[model samples]
Target: MERARKPTALATTPGLPPQPQVTLTDSNARLTATLPTGESIDILLHGATILSWKDAAGRENFWLSDAAKLDGSGAARGGIPIVFPVFGTSDGHGAEKLPQHGFARNSRWEFLGKSTSEAAKEGVKLDFGLSSQNLSDDVRAQWPYTFGLLYSVTLDRGSLNTTLVVTNDGDVPFEFQTLLHNYFRVDDIEKVTVKGFEDAPYVDKADQFKTKTQAGAVTFAGETDSVYTPAQGPGHPLVIEEDGKPRFRIVRDNLEDAVVFNPWVDKARSMGDFEPKDGWKKMLCVEPGSVSKWQTLEKGDAFEAAQTIYLV
Candidate 1:
């Protein structure tokens, strides 16, 4: 009998740069993207939450609480949590019965896989999907509308882009609100200032939801929960500066409202999942969304919005 032929190993082509990679870990519950330049991102299937984002130098760009639950027990306390359907508690408009921030942050999403594009600086984009059929009976009974959500997370050289597409799969129209609750890590919350909201009108949620206009760039003092509608319009870039130097710049597409929040001392200590009691001193939330009013989505129609955060 002739001897079996030996198998040969495949080799990578020379002179080409290393490609970006996407890895699934923790029994496929988490997806991580590593770029050729050493930048990386981690996302969980639960709520499709982005848990961590690191630069090429291995410095973390987002904050994740030490006490955050990663076992899918509850919404992670930090990082970027996606808010959909109803923002916070509903105020009538057909979503009053829905839970706070709706079900997107609490529901498990399906990983739709990843794709690469040279147009995005050879970056990799991961897609996630959540639909009405995937919802629990309790959640479905509360809203009773068939909808689909397509979330894309792209990791580029010096930026991260997140886009959401909401499709009305049912026969009736539905009103909803959406936002990206980004918990950004900072060296010192007191030294951080958020620009691009100057002269904008905002609602001070910490003060009985009073409406006020922002006089200057936002700074931290105590408990802060203000939602601003920028006069500069939807595509303007919001800059986060620390110690008079730019740290991160956020640009939103089709997302008009911005929310700045920090639980501060008292509220931070009250939250069971927020660690170290003083952990609030190291994080700030500069969220972009469409929360000033409910977005009405007609049947068979879709609405899309995106935000890109760049390191500075």
Candidate 2:
């Protein structure tokens, strides 16, 4: 994994508010009722917590990280973070140009608008934006690309739907990898299994591009890493079953790849930020991403990907 260069500080937008100043701050992570539907969804970038995300019948649909057990101060690092152009790797080995996951997620994005109206369902929709104009010197020095990453999250109609549009606004074009990095809540990693794209080609990172498949209904017995390729078209639905029953189905459209990572033991012990045993069984990182040939965005051009998680 190449490290990105350390970023230098850039001047802030002349009239932007200081970081994390919400007009309605109950806490950094709190659920607010929206207009039409009146459904609430928990947001935890302040602390990886999701206090709400249930159905009308009150069924726990999404998986919550064990760290989600909030302390007196509420914050969890394991919830949802929009990973930009790159993930897990920088431009070099131990650079500060970009942090481990890039600047977009670490920077506090502005919540422009929100709604829970008829245009959507019982959940909420939030529109957030990040652009080169607002980036710090640190981010600019690392990649030197001017761009905007817009995220739209809607918990409506019994599904968690998100859309990310990466727009290149610099004088020159740029290329990079990305993922939604969704940490879906589940009952037990042991009790859960994923079904879809069995026999589909996958890249074995250890073998450096070797491809293989395990047929159908892949079960997570240990650490697993497979980059599912060419995941376009009317793709098969991915179902995560718990206790021999279907808990939820992840439905995607026009997606190119699925990065399935279940770092059961190794990831836990290695990362101090995560409680290995607590996280090992409660959630799965099923990312909808673009890699292989990095998704390129031309100046003023945009690329988009979206999906819905229907609670069953």
Candidate 3:
């Protein structure tokens, strides 16, 4: 038998230590999981940005944009990212437009490690932290409230749960608006309808911003925008029906307002990247946002709001 050639160091050690089992970086927030079909979900919280969300089928069609980059750029409410600290334009109760959705969403955040229970059986939870001690020019120029924001994102059993924990770090109290601007993917907007808030109170985006009744099950007839107040509680699931069959369910807790929007005509056409006509027909936004008035969070106190998205 020919003597085997002396094994070279390179040949003996194949492929860099198996590439280190797990990848821990700012983009992934150090969470862990292996999907049933052998895929993964990565959560990036720097500036509260969702860096990447790849499904089991190796599909990552979800929107991923830098929240920080959109500051003062007027692209605030167009994606799946969540922003807090006086959502929308506050009419006069400390609603500062310059900071639109506060600095937490756009400011860099520090990883807080595996949530005391970050990883769950059905999903993995990752936590990030931000406090006044970490504020910079951009944050200070805004609300000027000394606070801490803890963001928890969990991916499990065919859905994602995002929770926001706001803590008061200052000596005084403050009031603000919040929102989890959910950007759900769908086959087509025309082929779907949002069912949940029917007959519930809603303020139309048009007609001088007055409250009105839905009159019937929600459907995309045209450019639709409305602010809902005194929203129905638990069990009143916000169902997104695709072709009359439930496709996805959005459930929110402790959120008093639910804003629904689909920019079909004017607003969609104004954006260069958005194919006005096709865009609206492709996506419908159901904002589980807190607005129309300010909610209070006192010193040394904390408040939380969360929402879960599930496949149907």
Candidate 4:
């Protein structure tokens, strides 16, 4: 059997800057990275949350709610929000309660600097690290497991490569779930078709978490929130397209499942953070994650997951 390689850095793309070309947005502290190819991406340092990603043509294709805050008071209403420690409101362990998606999406991470390798032939990658070392008492009180997390966001001409490396730095073992809550933009939600779920069983959140096997490609007609496990194989990448042209192509590694969601009319009205009740018509969140099973990491152990997104 072939040995699998452990992830230690960002996956290389064709062109990389000698160093990350970084700048801060004048309007907000969001950091922008411009690749040598002129493709660019924006990351808010507060949560290491991706705010915007532009394709080669400089056309932005990611979703951001008009009411989303760049100040980081809460998770930004859109783009790619990181989920860590716990996947949702309650971890079901009867422990102390946590916010909807844990604290990673709302906590500030340290900028560990950027690097590149001529031997590796990779693009400039930004490294952001988070440690419980400086977490406030309030944040630590909820789920106190010491950890070190390194998040790398790499910009490519047609794709964005994001990887999360989580290490258990505590004395005891810990269990957790994580997800990458990505909201992709579309001209019309109903018009887009998703491929790669066929024959896979899913937990339909709207149907009371009932498990059903996908008969074919998925399309949006009403509010949709479904979780599909072991979501890939020979079909490989998940493609979201309209009129047979690819919009977003998603590839995942070490991530075991996918969450497909759109809040639609009623849920959108109930969400105070979602701007404009009609915003649901233009976006969809096809998140890849490890929510199918909780990960138990022993002391000094590490876990990694990555998602590569291509926009055409």
Evaluated against the true structure, the overall lDDT of model 1 is: 0.93
Scored against the true structure, residue 48 in model 2 reaches a CA lDDT of: 19
Q: How do the residues 64-142 of candidate 1 rate in per-residue lDDT, one tens digit apiece?
A: 9999888888888788999998888976988888888888999999999888854475799889999999999999998
> Which portions of model 1 show Cα errors greater than 4 Å?
1-16
Cα RMSD of all models vs. native, in order, equals: 4.5, 15.5, 6.8, 10.7
For residue 127, give model 3's deviation from the true position in Å.
0.6
- Residue-level lDDT of model 2, residues 110-226, one tens digit each, is 566776534444345777677777766766788788788777777665577777778988888887776666676777888878777666678866346578865777677777777
Give the Cα-based TM-score of candidate 4 against the true structure.
0.89
Q: Which ten residues in a row have the lowest lDDT in candidate 3?
A: 13-22
lDDT of 3 by residue, 1-312 (tens): 766896556545455321112246634533344454444555444465553455667765354323323332333334456667777665555556445666656655677754322444444566778887787766575667788888877766567777888898899798877887765556777788888887788889766777798766688777878887634673367888989899778888777778887777787766565643455666677778667667788889998888877767
RMSD of 3: 6.8
**Backbone-clash count (model 4):** 1
TM-score per candidate, chains pooled: 0.94, 0.78, 0.79, 0.89
Clashes of each: 0, 24, 2, 1
Best by lDDT: 1
Sort by TM-score, top down from the best: 1, 4, 3, 2
- Per-residue lDDT for 298 in model 1? 94
Residue 36 shift from truth in candidate 4, angstroms:
3.0
